[model samples]
Target: MQTITVEPLAQEHIQILRLTSTPHLSGGLDTIAPYSVWITYRLNTGANQHTWTAAVSGYRVLRNGVTDMDAASIVLTNLADQDTTPDWLTDLIAKYTPSW
Candidate 1:
């Protein structure tokens, strides 16, 4: 299990969790495209929140860190239709909302 340091619970103004799946591309050459996943996360603002979903490749994520889930190659780059909640994430949530 990997870990990422995010904004402390008290300092955090927003947070989001997203699930994504990469589609299998079948083709010879020109038609082939790098595998990518469509992910969505919940953005919790101090006053409001929303969800943001996008189709992105693992390379992009590694190249550009995506919040606390950054550099999660094995976790984010794999092909699967499921949800993964890291322990750190759970802890973070609990820290913010003790009752949850």
Candidate 2:
């Protein structure tokens, strides 16, 4: 079973400052243990075709007491400036790559 929960750490009008993810639990990616799960959502509202601004957005690998996979401090850039990925996020992606 896999689950992802989002909690607003800080909000400002239509722009959220610090959005965080709850403890994500999964059986592992394709039978692997201790894997990272990262999820992304669209910020565009389809009603009138408008997009909201988010100052921060990312996933944190929840563990018992390990900061090695924790991404709570990572802040994502805007969509246009997202060409370069953050080192921390990249690390988690590599660590959790499905081996199956």
Candidate 3:
């Protein structure tokens, strides 16, 4: 799980509802591949209750028999600045990478 900080939204409140991952299955039954990981997060905001889902994908590297995933490669959807990656999101992705 990721620790998300509620940043000041200028009269708006954003709440992260859920975070889930859909892993790519390998050839064997119930086997998961670490190459591709898809992470999805649902969020609700403000009084009107606007909700949205963001999906991010990244590949994990297997080096020295250890699995490693880079958060910098994970791209988040619906961000104001696509070139700039948020710290919180990077932390979240790093925290969840081990589980995948």
Q: What is the TM-score of each candidate against the true structure?
A: 0.20, 0.22, 0.22
Q: Candidate 2 residues 1-100, lDDT tens each?
A: 9898976443222322222343332222211122233223333333332222222322343455333433333333335434444454444434433322
Candidate 3 stretches with Cα past 4 Å from truth are 1-83
Model 1, position 15: C-alpha lDDT score:
34
Report the Cα lDDT for residue 50, model 2: 24
Better of 1 and 2 by TM-score: 2
Candidate 1 residue pairs in backbone clash:
none
For 1-100, candidate 3 gives per-residue lDDT tens digits of: 9999876442322323243454432221222223333444333334332222234333443434333454223334434433343454455544543211
Query: Can you give the lDDT of residue 4 in candidate 1?
Result: 86
Error of 1 at 94 (Å): 0.4
79: Cα error in model 1, Å: 21
